[model samples]
Target: AVFLTAFMPDCDGPRTRVIEEVPVSDWMDSVVDEEHAPPSVFLGPEFVRRKLYQLTSEEDYTLCQSLARVSSYYVADQQQRPPFSAARYGAVTKVYVIAKQDLAMVEEYQRQMIAGIPVAEVREMADADHMAMLSAPEELAGHLADIANNYT
Candidate 1:
């Protein structure tokens, strides 16, 4: 058996448009306080170049392609909605480890999303933001270990 932890992708969605549209600096200011503002207001060209390079790297391209395909499918599925359906994947169990901060954005799907799925667990990492792995690695690792022990 394998245990997996959920994480938010580095992309903005309709529900996060307000924070996404704001200058990155403004958003950071509110979240981290002006006194500790980030070095740059927005993602500089250098950062973008590095990210593009990383995304296109041989080791990551496969994941990039898979994400692109999934994104396209999600959009198309949304446009032709009947009732919500789960994505078809071979995993024996799927646990959606949602961050407390991201709950607002995904709340709408809470009722319809897990209708027939066997969600082995739905753990919330309290006091953690979207990037919990980076912000709270120890806590995240503990949770993952616990999940692994229980599942395996």
Candidate 2:
């Protein structure tokens, strides 16, 4: 599996193990639902573009303006998920593709994740942002194809 600027969990740790705290300001005009064990926030356009789709085109950015969904952060149902054991899911060949321009997760944090999860290989797309498939779709696809051809 290729992780493209995503939430990468260590095989032996929680999903939030390497995640940095997102500041309240970063959430912008979030409409929050406190019904869950922890409140879920719906990201506004400003936050989404700034953090996730910074390098994407106007059309791509516009698509999110209407269809953005609530964030699963701090949700109650998923908090109980256990880590991936070394003998199970972790045994798969993992290839992490780092989006260097990603503002949401950032490259340093991405490297930190690879450090924890023993990946078969690590690739980097220097121009891509967090939403790499949108920002750099062709490059991302090429990388994925390469990984599948060689690694899988």
Candidate 3:
């Protein structure tokens, strides 16, 4: 699947706030230092709602791990990388499905990304969070199915 839910790289919007704040200790726990080895960043349970999966159900939130580690170097690299060029995927249909209730990236930033990139189509998940697959599974799945049917 395409990168449907995550914040886009080139949107000069409020999502930049999240990127600017990510390397800080309060938001990320650097478990593996790149100075010694490959760098890794972990997000605690408390950070899930505010940063990753806002509006997630209590049960799923609890099921979520307090520490989920990912490569800090990779994340840092992504922040510096340029946005994907639409010309590279000549005939591919690019659809952006926005999660309106996502607090991590915010709705305004989502719209800004779409406007900046010029997607083939835009769809909204009114009540969905960043983790829409868990927060609003059926609706997300329906959208996915529709995309597959129409785009593919």
Each prediction's total of clashing residue pairs, residues at least 3 apart in sequence or on different chains, is 0, 0, 0
lDDT score of model 2? Answer: 0.78
Task: Order the candidates by lDDT, highest first.
Answer: 2, 3, 1
Please identify model 3 stretches exceeding 4 Å from their true place: 10-36, 70-72, 76-86, 89-91
**Worst 10-residue lDDT window, candidate 3:** 9-18
Compared with the true structure, model 3 gives a TM-score of 0.72
User: Highest TM-score, which number?
Assistant: 2
Error of 3 at 99 (Å): 0.7
Candidate 3 colliding pairs, count: 0
| Candidate achieving higher TM-score, 1 or 2 | 2
Query: What's the TM for model 1?
Result: 0.39
For lDDT, candidate 1 versus 2, the one ahead is: 2
Taking all chains together, the TM-score of candidate 2 against the true structure is: 0.85
Which candidate ranks first by lDDT, i.e. highest? 2
Candidate 2 per-residue lDDT over residues 69-135, each given as its tens digit = 8776663444467766778777888889999998878788788778877889899999999888898
lDDT of all predictions? 0.40, 0.78, 0.66
Tens digits of per-residue lDDT, candidate 1, 19-124, equal 3333444232122222332221232333322322222334444443444311111323233434323343424565656545432233223323343346667776
TM-score of each: 0.39, 0.85, 0.72
